[model samples]
Target: MASKKHNDHYTDYFGITDKKVPFEDLDVHNDTRLFLDPHLVRLRTSPRPYWDQAVKCLDTFLETLTVRVLSRNEDPGDLLKHIQEPPETHLGMARHGYRGHAASDVIAQRIWESLTTDLYSLFRVGLLEHIEDLPLFVRGIDRDITSDITTRVFFDSLAQFTMSCMRQIPELSSRGTIQIEKTVWDPSHKQWAQRTYTVPKNNDGSGIILIPRGWVRKRLLGSASRFLQTETLTYIQHSRAQYDHRGKLVTPSKKTLRKELAKEPHQANIFYTEAAKRNRQNLIAQFWQYVDERYTEKGPNLGDGLARP
Candidate 1:
């Protein structure tokens, strides 16, 4: 009786009531042919709602991951502690220099390590949670299927689908060696440091390194001693002007003029202007360093032209 019912289900699925109607004789090209098999028609239409639910589930999962994993604030000092000391002074207080923070080498290593660890943790947790919640998100599917088995099947199907999509883009499908450059802040000298890695397409995921923008900025600013020096000088000169020499203001001394030119407002303005210019130059140099590291291919020389806008 069980065998008879199973055979009947197969017959209904193929839309063949009479065994005498050979499967090869059916007109496969006919538009009406697809509707003949109720199972085929249902399979084609059912995936839309399931896919919609899956996307919603993915969005919710990402939101949770961003809040819980990516946005967790860690102490700068603690993160810096993992940095390894470098052999020589590579960073400093000048333009494109690493400001003298705790130490450049140590800070750079720490930033790399902390970000990589955080990203790995995020990926692991996010994937696991998404798979675990699949049953809840995907509806009107086989309820008897185990979550573990379903998750595997879903991922396998997704991987196959992704590969098929990627085939349309030749650039993505091509296999080649790629170089990845990473910019790290060196604290000992206030500057950016770059490291490059060559990764083969086969071993691509193993070479992935994640660095947070906030972490990089924090290190860059932390090592920025040159800015501090300029600010200090400006503050000192301004403060000196506030003090009166007895009742009347004292004449500009040679030492004062040479050091800061604080006595004359015109000279003071010039000094501030020069300092501001230097700071801007330094920032521009830093920006160029990043540009060079990321976009290695030679192109038009924009140079100081970019400073205009």
Candidate 2:
């Protein structure tokens, strides 16, 4: 009976009585298909919410770093430092096994090439406003990389958040000594610093960083696929449509647009990139980001949906 037991969740393995815990019921053994979303992060306005301070740290640091890099005034060391593999939060899509946040010097190289070399006109026209937007308009950037950057920026706060949640669990509280040390952005100092945090132990004794149940979705807010299908296609539907002989404008349905865009991924990328560059004043990043946010506020969805509209 013991050998035949099937445990799919941490609670099942740990025998947690409270099934409706505040934090997500993560699988310590594998990566869950979820991402720590910044849109949701900003919605946390509960008095004394830990995320409020973290938002400043994250946005300011990412914008500053990107600006400095674009201006050719940034140090190579800082760029390399910013591109780091974040500790596993047990959230995100991972193949083979659950390696939460992953990136290396190669990603740093790609980012450098993207900013200075890639023909991403969106960056030059000022539409590439947020860090999350990189994956949308910039080639070689992916959700995994964005998720890594987000976790790194919110590292210390996540640790603190984990500690705060630990008190609500008896097993976690018993072992809550804040013993793990990791590098994180210190909002107080406006720089990265080392910090210790108490994390829930995995079955094999590894630490698991827990995110709030409402803080994640199946994909990041600026998901390329979702943005392409929704905002990008909507733009194409209007701009690409023509007037009939009766002088009435004809618009293609989403299904028709989707089928057209599905012909070639690169063709769709070029279409949206041009569309975004053309309507700089109208096609803002916040618009698309918010759409993903509102669709996922109900919490993480275990689906690979492109979040139409």
Candidate 3:
């Protein structure tokens, strides 16, 4: 006789009884497609309630990895050895002032100057957390190509790689990458400036995918929400006029201050959004360093670890 198995409506297991329901019992809606994958959903509607906290988490993670690498006594002596040798023929133009002004020396100097300016521009706005780029620049001055490659590999390998790997671990599976872009709001400019990026994505083989204005706005809004929640210290400024106050005890309306404070969140949002974009570029720079370093030693470990978590 075949074993008898009753198709009961409910199964008695754990604390609750499982009620048998038809497969079609669940309701399907248009929104279902949007939330199919959590990462896709978060990417689409980032800056969720926990985004501020998430950014803090991300910042801490980055800092920890950076400290770990910097603290280590193990030096990548290979990069130094490589720096001793002249670059290949491909770098001749780069060495001989092909991409700058005046003589090759002037061009090189200008190139370095411009690069430093751009870097400082990013740093002033808080995109850069540390000043390690200066050391990297000094190391790579003579052999620009090799030096650039070396530094790039180091950053990427250290942070991006770890982030990529951590995401795979069971506890962090739900976490996704944070991305940022930039947009200029000045009305007078003939051509507007804008940029988009995917955090964590660029570390992998895939680069930051630039999206449209609509998407950029969404990203900013989300990131702003995150920033306000995390950075407890409020950012503010005060200005006083000399000549105007001499006339009398003239007090500007408290209403104006209130209005400005109210608007601060919006302004802060824009500032941080732009900040995130600059940071993205720095992160990308570090990623390239990781790539260069890996190839220099191992010749090419093109496995899964290349993409940062």
Query: Which segments of model 1 are wrong by more than 4 Å?
Result: 1-78, 81-173, 176-226, 242-309
lDDT, candidate 2, 1-309, per-residue tens = 012134367666556778887677876567767767665566554323666766877777766656656676434455447556554586666643465336777777667765654534554566665666566655556666766777788777777777777776766544333367788777666677777776776654567777766776666666556667766677777777989999999988878877877655444654566665666634445455556566556444424454555
Q: How large an RMSD does model 1 have? A: 26.2
* Superposition TM-score, candidate 3 onto the true structure: 0.19
lDDT of 1 by residue, 92-124 (tens): 122221111233444434433433342334333
CA lDDT of every candidate: 0.28, 0.63, 0.28
Models sorted by TM-score, best on top: 2, 1, 3
lDDT of prediction 3: 0.28
Best by lDDT: 2
lDDT by residue (210-240, candidate 3, tens digit) is: 1111111111111222233322112211113
lDDT of 3 at 120: 38
Model 2 earns a TM-score of: 0.77
